[model samples]
Target: MIVVLIGYMASGKSTLGRILAKKLNYDFLDLDDYIEEKEQLLVSDIFKSKGEIYFRKVETLYLKMLLENNTKLVLSLGGGTPCYSDNMNFIRNTVKAKSIYLKASIPTLVSRLKTEKSKRPLIAHLETDELLTEFIGKHLFERSQFYNLSEVTITTDNKTEEAIIEELVLKLF
Candidate 1:
């Protein structure tokens, strides 16, 4: 089985994916990191040099490639991966692939992202917690529709990583 983790930035997709992979003895592949390794460039660099349209195209391509080739794997996707293209539909329809949405409250997302904004290109330019909160609220509202389409929806708000993982394990099995 393939486990795909989808959520907004700082929603713990990568971290949970790593832990879940270790627990399940599955290969862990972060889609952004995979793209970076394959393209020999940072996602930020891809956005800066080639623009979002190009980046989205490559992202979709790699997503399809990985879904086609991998099994017994844990895949953590970029926050916007599902919102663009028909990626969410593809993920949902793909056999043996399970997509789990890590649903976080806007406040939870804002609190986590405020400190780590520099590491995330999309939210890096957002200054001040208020601005970040506002942006997350609106962005999350827009993205939630796509996110809610996942096979499983796990709320991460106020939950420890271990707790979240535990719940996910119960759900998956």
Candidate 2:
């Protein structure tokens, strides 16, 4: 099975996915990291040098390649991956693929993304917590529709990674 983890920035898709993959003994692949490795450019650099449209197109290509070619895999996608290129539908329709939305409240997301903004390309330019919170609020609202299409939704606010993983495993099996 291909387990695809989707959510907004700092919602723990990649972090939880690594542990989930370890526990399930599945091959773990982070789409952004995969893109960096394959394209030889940092995700942020891709955005700056080529633009978001180019990045999204490449992201969709690699998403299709990974889902089509792998099984027993845990795939963690970028925050905007589902919102672009009909990627969520592709993930949902893929054979043996299960999409899990790691849902986090806006406050929880803002708190997490505050510390993580430097690493994330999208919110890095927001200079204040208020701006960050506003961005997250609006971005989450826009992307929630795509994210809600997931086969499973796991709320992650104030939850330990182990607890989230436990819930994920139960729901997945």
Candidate 3:
């Protein structure tokens, strides 16, 4: 079985996914990391050089390849992964992957991301809180439909990673 974690930036998808995979004895793959490995480039570099269109195409390709491998894995996707091209349907239909969206309010997201701004490619350059809020708002709006398509949705506002994963494991397994 494959579990796919989806959500907005700083929503704890990767951290919770790693913990869930460890407890469940499943392989863990962060989609961005996989793409970086496959392309021999950082995600930031990919965005700078190839543009989001190209990066997304590569993302789709990697996702299909991962599904074909058919291993028990937990995949943590980029914030925008599900919003593009048949990606959401591909995960749901082809792999029959359990999709989970870790939802968070804009305030929570902005607060969490403030500390890690240097690590995120998309939001790193936005210096002001207002700019960050606007960016997240646009992205959340664009991707909400796909995010909402998940079989399970967990709100992460003020919740600990351990608690979120515990709840997720119960619902998914």
Identify the leading candidate in terms of TM-score. Answer: 1
Distance from true position, residue 64, model 2, in Å? 0.4
Ten residues in a row with the worst lDDT in model 1? 115-124
Could you give me the TM-score of model 2 versus the true structure?
0.97
Per-residue C-alpha lDDT of model 1 across residues 67-133, encoded as one tens digit per residue: 9998999999999999999999999989989999999898888888888888887888998999999
Q: What is the C-alpha lDDT of each candidate?
A: 0.94, 0.94, 0.89
**Model 3: which ten-residue window has the lowest total lDDT?**
90-99
* Per-residue alpha-carbon lDDT of candidate 2 for residues 69-122, written as tens digits (9 for 90 to 100): 999999999989999999999999997999999999999998887887877767
Q: Is candidate 2 or candidate 3 better by lDDT?
A: 2
User: Estimated TM-score per prediction?
Assistant: 0.97, 0.97, 0.94
Clash counts for the predictions, in order: 0, 0, 0
Candidate 2 pairs with clashing backbones: none
What TM-score should be assigned to candidate 3? 0.94
Superposed on all Cα atoms, model 3 deviates from the true structure by an RMSD in Å of 1.2
